[model samples]
Target: MFLISMIIWATALLGAVMTVWALTWAIKRGEFRNLRKGASSIFDAGEPIGRQTDFFPPVRKGVR
Candidate 1:
């Protein structure tokens, strides 16, 4: 149905517009201005980025 397709397209376009609008609003409101600080705030230097146990591959029970 052409009418259904048009509605779907319009809704998708509207969603995209809203997403861009919200992102712009956040940037204008200074939500993402401190990119460097935000990255550092997430982790401490003394902690490992990942677990040490992940260094080795798991053994397969029955490989062909």
Candidate 2:
């Protein structure tokens, strides 16, 4: 019982430390500087913004 409690506490502490470290690293690297660009990184010229290009398998054939 004591050992299980210690393990859980240690795991929680480690998770919190890792989360803080990751946030700090991202801040130092300017990862959050360009929010809009990052949000649209997956899009391309062929698939412009506000345009729905993807269709599910069942609805794909009927689209065209």
Candidate 3:
């Protein structure tokens, strides 16, 4: 019985510590600036900044 109780307490303590650590790291990294920032980051803004065609140019036919 004692072993079971100890295991439960240890699990609870570990979960609490992880929660606290994640919150602290997020606060330090400015993750809470705005909720939409996370969603917006998934989108692309117009064309890419660099030349993308360099890697994926169209192939010419009968050029050989």
Candidate 4:
């Protein structure tokens, strides 16, 4: 339908405009200067929790 096509075209145009605006803003604000400064800060403190579970016995396929 004509209405559906027009809606899709409008959406695509709006998305493209927003993406360009974001990139330009980032460049102007120097947000891309530090590429990896804080990239590893999340894992710098400690490992993830609750990966080990000895509370329950291991699965036995032959019995259960």
Candidate 5:
């Protein structure tokens, strides 16, 4: 029982440390500098904003 408890505590501590380290690294790397650009990074000229690129099956003509 004691061994299991110690392992659990150690794992929790490690997870907490990793989370803090990742957050600090991101802040130092300026990952949160660009808000809008990052949000639209996946979009390109072929698929601009406010444009529906995907269409479901059974698409009828002259039906938007």
Candidate 6:
């Protein structure tokens, strides 16, 4: 029982840390800026792919 609790706590902590890291990573990578502009650009199909908002998270270790 102790082992199981430790495993669960460790997993939860790892998940929380990874989540914050990813959010900051995205912001630093300019993924959240100009979100409205990026969405608007989608409708303008004729235009080339310009600045876009990345809503998806990065596939990192133990990120499910």
| Between candidates 1 and 6, the lDDT winner | 6
Cα deviation at 42, candidate 6, in Å, is 4.7
What does candidate 2's lDDT look like per residue over 1-64, in tens digits?
9999999999999999999999999999999998999999988888888899877767566596
lDDT of 4 by residue, 1-64 (tens): 9999999999999999999999999999977777686464444334534344346777888975
- What is candidate 3's lDDT per residue for 1-64, written digit by digit as tens? 9999999999999999999999999999989888786756755666434435346555789654
lDDT tens per residue, model 5, 1-64? 9999999999999999999999999999988999788899888999988899887777689876
Q: Quick one: RMSD of model 3?
A: 6.6
The list of candidate 1 runs beyond 4 A from truth reads 44-64
TM-score of each: 0.50, 0.69, 0.56, 0.53, 0.75, 0.57
Candidate 6: residue pairs that collide: none
Poorly placed runs, candidate 3 (over 4 Å): 34-36, 45-64
Tell me which residue pairs clash in candidate 4. Answer: none
In candidate 1, what are the lDDT values of residues 1-64, reduced to their tens digit?
9999999999999999999999999999988988887776755666645534335666788953
Q: By TM-score, how accurate is candidate 3?
A: 0.56
lDDT of 6 by residue, 2-30 (tens): 99999999999999999999999999999
Error of 3 at 63 (Å): 41
Q: Which ten residues in a row have the lowest lDDT in candidate 1?
A: 47-56
Off by over 4 Å in 5: 59-64
What ordering of candidates by TM-score runs from best to worst?
5, 2, 6, 3, 4, 1
Reference-based TM-score, model 5: 0.75
